[model samples]
Target chain A: MRPRVALNIKSVDYEFLQEQFGSKSELLLKSNPVHKKIPVLLHNGKPICESSIIVEYIDEVWSSSPSILPSDPHNRALARFWAAYLDEKVPLFWVITAASEEEKNAAVDQLKEVAVEMEGAYGETSRGGDFFGGDKIGVVDIAFGSMLGSARAIQVRVGVKLLDEEKTPGLVKWAEKFSADPAVKDVLPETEKLVEFAKLLSAKFKAAAASDPLRR
Target chain B: MRPRVALNIKSVDYEFLQEQFGSKSELLLKSNPVHKKIPVLLHNGKPICESSIIVEYIDEVWSSSPSILPSDPHNRALARFWAAYLDEKVPLFWVITAASEEEKNAAVDQLKEVAVEMEGAYGETSRGGDFFGGDKIGVVDIAFGSMLGSARAIQVRVGVKLLDEEKTPGLVKWAEKFSADPAVKDVLPETEKLVEFAKLLSAKFKAAAASDPLRR
Candidate 1:
């Protein structure tokens, strides 16, 4: 979905292939033999794994579009820094759903803290503009925006508000702006749908754990 | 050390500020507020953290040097993929020194597997050239090359060889070639010195654990 948003933002045509839960295709395994995960963008038959890397590749290949990363080198570094930070926090989202209640609360707190820092990052990068990329959705926006579905579903499932208006007004507003963007609106999965999907996923995990307690 | 190697390769003279083992400097804290870690490159007072990001930043800012990333977009994506893979494997190095004996053996086995995969990566990316960047070291070379000192020291301290000549001949050869490069030879620490440093670090970890068993 993240790469699709990037492709849409770049105005490039692509074929969307969805991988089913609890199973992977031979194509995915062959394409991404390292991680064998999703969001692997196949361009000219070469696979680019990792959402941010694929987004950067999209930006580089489709140079005619507005740049995803900033023009200045330092600003680009900051953009990449924020993108990496978002990626680093990915495991927290998992812990929120799968761990003990204390661990879930801790993950929530950490994510809230991350949202605050990202609020500052949005302020610094946006320069009073509407989005993290400053008036247009850039790499950082896409990176964080990709996770909003899970964040929203986590809110619904875990009863925790991560990006609160009072605490991180900038991020809250940016999340709204990013979600409503035409390039991503259609690509971003619906919150309720994601909630259903998350339920199915958690059930699968429980089943797997019942079969093999040492699944991890 | 990784950033310094890139700076040297780029022929960009810069000042190096060493951070102490236990305490971070005010500047280091301010520069990299998020990670508060070392190898933050301060250029014109703007800080760029993370070794790979800093190397890419150096490449972008200092455009005249032999390109750190490949010119082709696909190759660049591949380079980034391999670099990210290397970065992801970083924590296992810590497990080598800090974890239990069984865990250390598992880490060694995992690292050896990683070396085999990286050998395949080197074969694909090098394109019959001497380095991962095809004769002139690029980002992947610097990424893995930066970790060579620790890998060599691990081989000495842990009684295991990760990048074995038979199992991962390409990576083993690449390691030697990368270490001998003029830009990185002086920057790479000696294996014996790194082994001693690792011993001290392990001892410190043990002392810290003794003081507080709950510390993660």
Candidate 2:
């Protein structure tokens, strides 16, 4: 059996709360008062913040069934490399969506650079198999796959499309394969729900930025 | 025999590199071309960039000796929490050292807040243990312990100490115990060397900031 770990998972859903601040979850606030962010997994009442680190903890705790990381060290490191890259780079998508026209264009250019790096990292010729590490889905897939919902929404909101089969053919295939996986598919929010949430969040950020001129 | 996973380790004497930039080794550049930073580990020619991630990879690959992480899930998560906390919070020291008088005072205030939080997290009153977990050294120690070298240097450079025994008795005792460990002590850099290097880096950053008006 998986260890009895308490996970205070949060999202931009409001049925559980009054408003969708995305950071209003009481459990999250108690655990990680410093960052006050979501996806804080508390094991034995002690909190481990950061989503990627939490996933790593989960993988270590429950080593049976589907292993999130690979057995080989090199392969595992590669998986981790991609995960870190995604965490460090993918936030630009939201920035692009929320930016002014000039800033938005600059962010789009940065996005293309990141996309090109991803393309190079996971090229058709290199990752010729199903997933990022080939054969099975691992942490890299989970890390990048989790962001795809937001990525799609950001693309739609910003009027800039990325991750096309023609443009990023390998990444497109990988995203499709990742979504189809039973385990991954189980946790993903619906695309429509996520898009609506993104729109709301964008409006909120824009409004806040307008009111607080220092934000720009 | 350990598996022949490609490994590149470094003793990053940042102080030494400041005086003699030639001492800034090529491994940092080779391992992380994109970030161009240090504490990178290259596994099978692919770079795992972040220091914490590198430590985890090292522990996973070389599991024979001392286990950097705890076996229990709860303890492991707790270890990871402090490690992430150190990474997120400890950078304030550099900021304080480099800031103007007003900014330095603000950073000092922020540092005090973090110190209180850290004391609460791993203090004698809260954890009631020797190390971050209990009894033995673990990943939290490694993650935070590595910073002790820099912490000591920063304390000397800034002329303000934050890790005194009386103020944070638990953390102080923990740091003392951690520094005494053979594994940690063997790898740590000399305090004098580190202080010298910190001075050089401070000057470099100041010069760069002066030249670049956009630097914040």
lDDT by residue (B31-141, candidate 1, tens digit) is 999999888999997889988889999999999958899888888988898899889888778766666787687778778888988888888778889998588989888
Docking quality level of the chain pair in candidate 1: medium
Q: Write the per-residue lDDT of candidate 2 for residues A1-216, one digit (tens) a residue.
A: 011111111111211223246547677678778777666655555776677777777777666746767788766776777778777665566655465776666666766667667777776323567777766666676677777777777666776666776678778878887777655565667767867777667777777755642231
Q: Give the per-residue lDDT of model 2 (tens digit) for B117-173.
A: 767767532355677666666666666677677768767776767677667777787
Q: Is the docking of candidate 2 incorrect, acceptable, medium or high quality?
A: acceptable
Indicate the DockQ of the complex predicted as candidate 2.
0.32
Candidate 1 residues lying further than 4 Å off, grouped into runs, are: A203-216, B203-216
lDDT of each: 0.84, 0.63
What are the chain A TM-scores for all the models, listed individually?
A: 0.92, 0.78
Residues A143-177 of candidate 1: C-alpha lDDT, one tens digit per residue: 89988999999989998888987989888888888
